[model samples]
Target: MTAFQPDLSSALAGSACLGAWAHDPASDRIALSPVLARLLAVPAEAATGTSLTLALAAVEAEDAVRVAGVLRAAGEDGRPFEAEFRTRPGPDGARWLRLMGRCGRDPATGAVTTQGLAFDLTEGRRPVGSDAQQAQRQVNRLADHAAAMKGLVAGLRNPPLARLVDEVAVEVGHELARHLRGGGRQVH
Candidate 1:
């Protein structure tokens, strides 16, 4: 029997609120998935060969320095990193994104690369008010859960099971983000 091969393009297309990215330390270049490119307000075509500075140009001024520092530290230490920052207002208006990833060396090329996922948190954010703080807390919890799930999946030896778990975690995160964005109202 032939092994199952999942169509990554279809999977990525279905995940509108999630994006993946990889950065090469030596070249200071970043490769963003189409969804990530859109979320970051970068053109999809341009994102594939974008420089790290260019990709990060979308980060809001307030968060740019801190995010850059985090990335620099991660690259230096080869550690996992998590950062939440906002993008400048574009056609889609300002968006909040949570990025989680780790730095590692590529065995074949002996180059260091940072890879991770970007989750759109804007939809789940409540407007400024008493509820806003609570909403932020909820968003943080969801991000924490996703990071924890990633760690768990990394430990799993079965590729199919790992992929299934990761997908479920992402779907659940999207549902929760949507619910928070809707002010916690019951759908039905």
Candidate 2:
């Protein structure tokens, strides 16, 4: 299991995030959440059956691919699965949230089951466009860069890619050290 970061407990309690779904291949139903109603870009009472498809459509184009990849990984070889991603909510009063999920087998039918925790990230008081916001965006960008580099390393199997990954590691370490010294979140 991934580290449940410090914010998980509250995110689960407030319903600030969305959820997981157990794929019922037989009943054609998906088990999910109602607060996630807006997330699916639909009404609150709407069932979860359509949320996955709708969510794929509504997620920012850049992130849609990642979400799709994670969704695809869920049913592989019947292994338990998990994924995390963030999407900028639409105009609806929805707030920014982090989604964490777990998928497994259904008890009765042995079909795939999905159960997840939705974490609401609405507690920060940092002003938009403020120093904190800028730092947060920086951290996000660096994280994305790190992920891409890691992916490249996994695919290329060459010394050049390894060197690139090493460079990124050095940069990340330097940034993290600076943050620790300054009392700020690393790269943020």
Task: Please write out the lDDT profile of model 2 over residues 15-101, one tens digit for every residue.
Answer: 544554444433434445666655546555555565455555655666667755555565454444444444556775434555555
lDDT of candidate 1 over 46-149, digit per residue (tens): 88878777788888886977877777777889989899899998888888888889999989988898888877878667466566667656766777777777
Question: Which residue pairs does candidate 2 place in steric collision?
Answer: 22-114
C-alpha TM-scores of all predictions: 0.60, 0.61
Worst 10 residues of 2 by lDDT: 20-29
Report per-prediction Cα RMSD to one decimal: 11.2, 6.3
Candidate 1 TM-score versus the reference: 0.60
- Per-candidate Cα lDDT values, in order, are 0.77, 0.57
What is the clash count for each candidate, in the order shown?
0, 1
Q: Which stretches of candidate 2 lie over 4 Å from their true place?
A: 1-11, 14-20, 23-29, 77-89, 93-96, 122-159, 182-188
Cα-lDDT of candidate 2: 0.57
